[model samples]
Target chain A: MITPSPALPIAVPLVAAAFLAGLRKFLRRWLADLIATATAAANLWLCTALLRASWHSNIVYWFGNWFPRGRMVVGIGFEVDPVGAGLATLACLLTLLGFIYSWRITDSGRDLFQPLMLIFMAAMCGFAMTADLFNLFVFFELMSTAAFALCGLKTHEPAPLQGAFNFAVTNTVGAFLILTGIALVYAVTGALNMAQIGFLLGSRHDLLVIAAAAFLCSGFLIKAAIAPFHFWLPDAHSVAPTPVCVLFSGLMVELGAFAVLRMTSVMFGQSLLQPHSAFRATLLLLGSLTVVWGGLMCFAEHHLKRVLAFSTISHGGAMLLGVAIGTPAAITGWLTYLFAHAMAKAGLFFTAGILLHRLQSMSEPQLFKRGRPLRFTAVLWLLGGIALAALPPFGLSNGEDLIESATHAHAIHLWVTLMFFFTSAMTGAAVFRVGMRVFFGLGDAGPADRAAKIDEAPDGPEEQHHIPARMFLPAALCIALSAAPAYIPGFGRWFFNAAHRFLAQSLYIARIYAQPVHYVLPPAPHSDLGSTLMHGAIAVVCALLLASWAVFHLALPRGFRGATHLEGPMFPLRKLQSGHPGDYVVWCMVGFVLLGGCLFLLP
Target chain B: MNQIVHIFPYLVAGWVFLCGLYGIATSRHLVHTVISLAVVQTSTYVLLLNIGFRTGGAAPVFADISPGITTVDPIVQALMLTDVVVEATVMALLLAMVVKAYEKAGTLSPDDLRLMRG
Candidate 1:
């Protein structure tokens, strides 16, 4: 049996990225596409090999081959478990799809886009596979910086620039926090390897240890866009190029959640499973709030991309809810949701981009114009929306079913489950509204706007046929692959088993807290004291109060107007958007200091 | 005195970092922002190296045949070296982006740019 090398997937892209950067100056128009496509294809091949090998064997590569040097274990390493390999394959596949999707978009400077994108892919792969905490930090920075640059690719546009600036500021602060935490850990344990750190810190909980954990977890939470830190995400995703936006919303942001899971599993696995666990409760609360908030924001959005962006956040919240459940079934649900969301969201973005290309606008109402062809794009959007809404026969449905089953026994879990269902329904409604506007609204056909919108000139036949087949092929492929997993028995099991291993393997909290502890509580008896008379009198008083309140409020002119007259003060907070760089910097600094202080000072 | 010597490097690193943060806060130009980021990154490198340094340790370079002789922690130094390269790459990319922004906007002053307001 031939086992795959773990380093190739990371090394190939790093080398290719460097090569592309050097050759970018002299490369022709199509050269960038060729290089990016080839590199991504190579990464995909390597990932496939790794996946096949990982099915039967775990691969580990010690850096510099220095692992057996006097039993010191000083060198860093790469540990490619089944889960990491699977995620790496998915990342590479999506990157290749993104490359293909952007093949026709020559407006973005090709020279810069391809290399940065390859670097981003390599960083993601490294982040998934690296065993060292410091290496993880490096890859985290790499992915983030690349993402920031990609967001600002349309640097002339005010929205993308602003979005990129905010993203950079927040993530840089996150990076600093992560680095500080790493420094603290290293100071305490003198180890950089993750497994080594776990072994060293075992059963030795200290103030410094908890402080470091909080700092690290907070940084990851910021990256994951779990609630308040998500303020930067909608703007960033909506303003970035459509394909890049898809990757960012669908895959890049989930890396944060993945980081949290990985770190917690390694560092605080045993501590997380205690009865009435505060950490689990906190996770559940944040996840629930994010779901509701993101759903409401999505419902309020009118722009096409921003709706999807908020929906992505809502889905992320759902995945985190599953993680908080801390069961094998819940982990499987989380992974399945991740897989389905990536495919569905990417396809949705691609379809939206295609519509925008044809209609020359992303506004919901503008899509109804007569000149735009709505049949194909609208159908694709609907399919993607169904998958996103967790309708039956799709991968999301299976995941949602598992999540429901896992959470139905507990009241708090049931409440979170209800929020997930509600938020998904709201997302479905938003998508339906957009679809209705696009397909059935008043048609606007002033003139033949094709010439103005399409970049193809009349004389150049080559340029006229520029909807390039490569662009849509990968999206269709992703959509098909997403649906295929549900039908294939073993494929879902592959991911399910990987997730099971992640939650149940060595260092899991379940191993430590497996024993059931008995708790004694004071018992109370049911009583029916003075029920008949009290019920009759309360019912009569309630009917009277309801009648009086309705007569006063419901029948008045103010009630009919429904607070429409007070629109001026309804959004007074809009004045806070100063658009000044100095103001933004100050706000960022304030947030950083407050968060840092809270992390260190809080008991 | 021993404690002061042990703490001095941290104070220097912190001072540099604070100066960089101040520069970033006050800077109106994109170039200045990039410069401030560089300064901040340099401070991190300083802190990393300082933490790795021992009181009587020699440089990390190999000189003699002895394997266990006093030598500095090479791991942090190597990590810092890689970090420097990454920082340089990020700085270059940021500068390039700033140039592109200037080409489009005709100004480096972020205050005047307001095309993407919600």
Candidate 2:
């Protein structure tokens, strides 16, 4: 068998997207869908090949075969490590699943949907694999451009237009911030390749480096939907179509966290990883804040999609914590968590899409007592919630175990554990509460709010009485496969070795120069499964209790129930999410200023 | 004055970026907001170009110049070119959305676009 090149994952999707886009007028919808699906599958296969090839060594493929001149890298390179290729594979996998789920829906723009999805997939693959900073920016723009257009796909309503608009503006600004940082880094190092930059910037802790770190981190953090810069996420996710939401929440946002990890490890390794680095603390604080804010909003909102969106933000924070910890074990946990979250979150969104298709609504109250017929889907939804809570036997719990064990010696390990517990419980409770209210009719009327009243356009050409087999298949597979990794014996040990290489800046630099270095694999860290299970059990119980309270609180004594109402306290916080583009811009500025100040002003 | 000249472009880039942000935070019309974003993007071009500039250096071309001659950095110029195209495409997409928003809601004021508020 011929070995697949690293560029095929990016090239196949790009060419297919252009082909589908160019012949859009001539091609039938089904034909276009077939081409897109085939392209995604091809990309996934190629990425898997690269992932396996890169299992032990980082594979660097230079574009145009332009080899580095002695010490200088003159050509753009795709440095494919297992983690990067694995992310690209996940992006392709999610795109393929989304296409399958969306096959029945007669998209608003007949041929526009598949091409954009292909382009988005292509961009994500490129973003995950590129070692060139400028190329990364280019792919970032490509991804955002495709996403913005896709968000506004439902043009019949003004909400999607508004959502897409805010998403475009904020993310565009973030991209620009990243570009500025790239400029600074190029100025200092005269290089754009991450490995070259790292080599040139060895042990430097200058102001330019600090400023560049701030700018890059700020930009990607915004994309990651870290709080204070996260105002645009809910608005965008809640308004976009369901399959599109799957991509947005599943892999796109998490790629931001992935970028931060790659950038810090490759380019700013020596400076940022030194002891007493405030950058680490700043990230931890931001992650904690995102966790609390997202968890609270996830439970408070009644719109099913918005609840899922906020839960994404919360889980995104947990991933950021793993990145911030900056250990091989922690990153291994991050990768596992990302896989589980992507699968489980996509499953949850699919369930939401099912609800929308059947009941013609996404609000819990509007959908209350109406989803009793979807008994199988309810089971899937409940399982999805349990997996999301990181309960034992689920893949997410295994990921949490690794992260918790990795942080066991840190000063703020307890705080990290608490944040993880809070996020899982609150987000899981929101899902459980929605499931009980809509599926089982176990709850009193859900609370009414302005957010729940927002207009939503349902997916598919028309509503159906019977659930389609295609729709059920993807959600079931996603939830089932989400737990598969945890059950795979010895997967953790293998993943830890891959992650250790991912964090080795010197090893990457050596690879780029075509020089071999002696490298030793550290002993695979042991996961404290017993403690992890205990924590997971507590979180699951808390989720159940919280869901029960949200549903049955009205039956309690008057004073107790009066105190139980939590939405009142959240009004001010929610008010910050005014959905105005200007307000979001203001928050972006505030976040940038604070991030810059914290990163640059600290001693 | 030499030092001042060297730093002037950097200051201007920073100033332009902040000004564009201010325009976005205060803008009432969607058109104005898009323009503000364009302004923000322009600062990147300025920054990238300024970083590549070398005083008294020739353009990075070898048609008539000696191989060892001092020349401005060509890579940053190439980067800026791509950045400009990306900025233009983003602006066009934003404007398209603005036109759609205007037709659907019959208003362009940010305040009136409160249909998604909490």
Candidate 3:
């Protein structure tokens, strides 16, 4: 039997997208969606096959058979390790689910959504698998261009235009930043292949390298929605169609963290693997700040999608923390957390889409007491929240366990534990508060926040009586799968093995050069399940208390409640997210300089 | 003079990048913002081309040159070409958004597009 080529996952969707776009006017809606859905499924199958093939070892596929001549790479390569392939697989799965969810939901554009979604999927798959630095930039631009177009899919709305514009500008700037970093690295190493560059620049710490690291990290952190660089995310999420928001929060933002992990491991692993490297410290500090900032703002938001958007930011911060730790166990935790978060977050967005479809609004106050009949959706929403809270028996709990156990010997263990608890609780509180207020009608309607005033047209026909099975199936499957890893029995052992190989830089270089791959696998790190469960339980209880406090604040005594409201103190922080693209650009510049200076001067 | 020539192009690229960002942050019109973004992208072209430049290098045209002839790095030029295409696409899309925002909101000023302010 002929094995499926690695490039098929990217090429199939792109070719289908072009075919669909060219013949859009002649094709009927069902035919277009059928072709897109089939293409997505085919891509998923191919990626899954690639994942299985790469499970034992990395699959290095050089285009046109131009293998690296000795140490020099002549052709672009797709290095498909299980981690990268798994990410590509997840992208395909989400895109397929997105297509299914949007089958009947009509947008204003004529047959444009499917093509854009296809291109977006292809770009993400390419980004996940490509090993060339310039190739990564090309795929990054392709992804951003597709995302900007998708965000502005609803040009009829003024807010979407503004949102898409900010997204385009900031992300375009980010792409340029990445390009600059790539240029700097190329200037020094004279190669665009990541493995070659890493081989050439081994253990050489210098000014240029520091600057490149800064630009690259900041560029991707912007994409990942870290604080100060995260202004575009909520704006984009607040206006983009529901199905698009699922991809945005589910995998795209997490891909930024994935890129950072990939870049550091392949390019700067030797220097950064130092015990007290300032680079890791800087990343850790930023991760903690992002968790706190994103969590607090998440709880303060009134818009449903924006709430989820901030939750994405908080969870992204947690992933960055895992990557920042840079242990095999930490990497495993990051991969697990990423998978669980993608599913649960997509499920939450799907449930929000359902509410928007039925109720014609995304404002928590507007949706208050109106979601009484969506009991199934309510259950999905709360289950997704529990996943976000890292409750036991969920994949998120396992991910958190692995990360904490990996860092137990470190001096910063307490700090990591606290950030995890705070972010999970805060984000969970935000979602739970919304679910209780909307589904159970436990609280009276509060005044709408400023975010509620933003206009958001529902993606589907409003006032729908019944949720379609297509829409509900994907969300249900997502929530179910988010809990699958915990029950899979040997999932941690298997994943830790894959992640150990992923973090093994020598094995990666060896694979690219077609040298005999001889590397002994380290024993997988063990999770302290007891400590993790205790912490997870506390986080869940804290989330419940916080949600209850926010929902029934009016009935509670003022003396007992203290002098602050959950949403009140967040006013100063919220002002930084002003919708002006100019202000956002200014902040992006500040972030670049600050991050560059830190990375340069720290060590 | 040699030192100045060696570093001149890099300095110019950095200056142009900063200027573009400054224009974006201070621009009054949305059209200007899009143009500023293009200007920012132009710096990458300058940087890439400058990196590939040699003192007496020829254009990277293999059809006419001998096998061992000195030529600029073809890869950076190729990268610059891709960058230009990406810039044009982004600019076109941003310009379209500017037009739509103007049509829907009746204004082009970022200050007036306050519909999404937190």
Task: Pull out the clashing pairs in model 2.
Answer: none
Model 1 DockQ class = acceptable
User: lDDT per prediction?
Assistant: 0.67, 0.88, 0.88
* Total clashing pairs for each candidate: 0, 0, 0
lDDT of 2 by residue, A190-236 (tens): 99999999999998998899889889998998899999899889989
Q: What TM-score quantifies how close candidate 3 is to the native fold?
A: 0.98
Cα lDDT tens digits for candidate 1, B1-118:
9899877877887788778778776778978877876777777777777768876888877865377777777887877777778777777876776777777678877666543233
Candidate 1 lDDT, tens digit per residue, A1-603? 566578888889888888888987888758778888899998998988887776643466787875724323477787676677878888888888888877746365447788878888888888988878999999999998999888887654545666676577666656766776786677677788776676667756566776577668767777888765566676677667776777787788888888888887776665434434555666776788778777766655556777788888888888888877867667777787788888888888887776666555665544554323556666777677666666655566666666666665677765865766755665665565566557544222111111112121111123222345665676667666667656776655676667765654352322222223232222211112233123323322432332233223334566453222211123232233334444444554554454445444534
Error of 1 at A70 (Å): 6.9
Interface alpha-carbon RMSD, every candidate = 6.3, 0.8, 0.9
Candidate 1: chain B TM-score against the reference chain B: 0.91
Q: Clashing pairs in model 3?
A: none
Better of 1 and 3 by TM-score: 3
Interface RMSD of 3: 0.9
Please state how well chain A of candidate 2 matches the true chain A, as a TM-score. 0.98
Q: What's the TM-score of each model vs. the native?
A: 0.81, 0.98, 0.98
- Cα error of candidate 3 at position A176, Å: 0.5
lDDT of 3 at A270: 81
